[model samples]
Target: MTLLGDAAHPMVPRFGQGAGQAIEDGFALAVLLEHAKRDKIPARLKAYQELRLERTSRV
Candidate 1:
């Protein structure tokens, strides 16, 4: 399984991004998985990772 938010990118709590990032992760993952078939789950998850990685890194 893949990880999200702090589980994927742990960071200091001073900026308070933990919960926000987790919510963002959940929404993004949900969108990617919404229409995915069993055979497409891997691709959807990878897409979610790529998108979130870029986004969270920049935040």
Candidate 2:
């Protein structure tokens, strides 16, 4: 299974991005999944990770 937001990268309370990041992760994953083939799940997830990691790391 794939992880998202706090589950993937929990942050200190001061960051105040737990919910927002979760939402962003879910939305991005959903969009990717929509166009992804069943056999391409791994690739899709990797894409999601790369996309979110770049954005979340800055938080």
Candidate 3:
């Protein structure tokens, strides 16, 4: 249901961040999903997007 890294924000290979961002996404997802409640999934994903979107946009 949630996309990460290239799936969320594809970039040129010149950036050299596809893999790194994917790892970061995975890490963040793990933390956000830990003991997450069904009702809170949306908020958790929103938090993930907020955390990553800004950084990826700058990159």
Candidate 4:
């Protein structure tokens, strides 16, 4: 459940959205780090994975 960006989606790096997902991951990680929270790690990661799974899979 440790999702990290569009590693699943893997866009063409066009429109600069490819790395956007990674940036979002970074932000999310930052928030969790700052709060020392781990409760939602698995769920959040799973959600991120699901979000990018189809989109990146097609790309």
Candidate 4 matches the true fold with a TM-score of 0.46
Rank list by lDDT: 3, 2, 1, 4
Error of 3 at 6 (Å): 0.4
Candidate 4 stretches with Cα past 4 Å from truth are: 37-59
Tens-place lDDT per residue, model 3, 1-59, is 79998999998897578888899899999999899999999999999999998888977
Clashes of each: 0, 0, 0, 1
RMSD of each: 1.0, 1.2, 1.2, 4.0
TM-score of candidate 2 relative to the true fold: 0.89
State TM-scores per candidate. 0.90, 0.89, 0.88, 0.46
lDDT of 3 at 37: 90
lDDT per residue as tens, model 1, 1-59: 78988999887786778778988999999998997899999999999988998888977
User: Model 4, poorest ten-residue lDDT window?
Assistant: 28-37
Instruction: Score candidate 1 by lDDT.
Output: 0.88
Model 4 alpha-carbon miss at residue 10, Å: 2.2
Q: Model 1 clash pairs?
A: none
Candidate 4, pairs of clashing residues = 9-56
Alpha-carbon deviation at 9 in model 4, angstroms: 3.2
**Model 2 misplaced stretches (Cα beyond 4 Å):** none
Best by TM-score: 1
Query: Residue 39: error of model 4 in Å?
Result: 7.3
